[model samples]
Target: MNCPKCKSVQIIKYGHTHYGKPRFRCQDCGRQFVLNATRQPIDEPTRQLIDKLLLERLALAAIARVTGVSERWLQMYVFQKFYQTPKAIDVTPKKQVG
Candidate 1:
């Protein structure tokens, strides 16, 4: 078997997953992964829809429900796509002397 992440052919049988699925490990990248997994990657149209929903300023939960994606994943995606460091704010209170 080959490693999905590194496309390396130096793979060996690892341990079983929690679901009892056979797992394999790649010697080259040291990544252990399962083969013939049922989970599929998100498609382009769905990603576009997520982007559109985000542009509309919808809540993360709402976007996840509409896009069939997890809220945590959406949050990470939004952060990666548009996250910027905010400018520092000065909040020192001035003392009033009578």
Candidate 2:
């Protein structure tokens, strides 16, 4: 079989994926792929909804259920977002009211 990325005929058997699907690796570009992929990527609208739900402080399980996404994926996404945020924040002092 040919590599999808580089369209090279140099391909090798890579191991099975977590879901037990047979995986192959391209020797040309080092890309791993399955013959038939079953998992569909989450779309942009669903991602926007997830962001809104995260802002609402909803439980991870609840967000996953509502958005129909795997909790594992949501957790990883949140982990990435957490690290992407600035480490330090500047706060303004509040003025005293009479």
Candidate 3:
């Protein structure tokens, strides 16, 4: 990372801030920087909305507009998580009971 003081690219990760922000230590001139990427995928409010939409079975595009999250990202979460697949009437198999 470039130094915030002198714009040098020599830097290393120190630790974290009080609020748990990533802290970087510059090796070029001994400068510390806190790398805070504000653009997070899902915030607390968005996460709550995600849960609500999942429960309500709402469409991804609509949810994306409301939460500012991409539909593809939402789909990844659904597929990766323990979500049950909706069964089709024609595709569902019949089990034989003996």
TM-score leader: 2
Question: Over 4 Å off in model 2, which ranges?
Answer: 1-38, 85-98
TM, every model: 0.45, 0.47, 0.42
Off by over 4 Å in 1: 1-40, 84-98
Better of 1 and 2 by lDDT: 2
How far out, in Å, is residue 14 in model 1? 22
Query: Which of the predicted structures, 1 or 3, would earn the higher TM-score when compared with the native?
Result: 1
Worst 10 residues of 3 by lDDT: 89-98
* Candidate that beats the other on TM-score, 2 or 3, i.e. the better one: 2
**Clashing pairs for predicted structure model 3, backbone only:** none
RMSD of 1: 11.9
Residue 2, candidate 3: C-alpha displacement in angstroms: 16
Q: Clash number for every model? A: 0, 0, 0
Instruction: Say what the RMSD of model 2 is.
Output: 10.7
Query: Candidate 1 lDDT, tens digit per residue, 16-94?
Result: 9978999999999999988753244566798899988867878789999998887767765676565444243343323
Give per-residue CA lDDT, model 2, range 34-60, as digits (tens): 886325466679889999998887888
lDDT of each: 0.75, 0.80, 0.69
Q: For model 1, what is the alpha-carbon lDDT of residue 75?
A: 64
The sequence of per-residue lDDT tens digits that candidate 3 reaches over residues 1-98 is 47767778888888899778889888888988776553443656777878798677676777777778877777666654543554542443233233
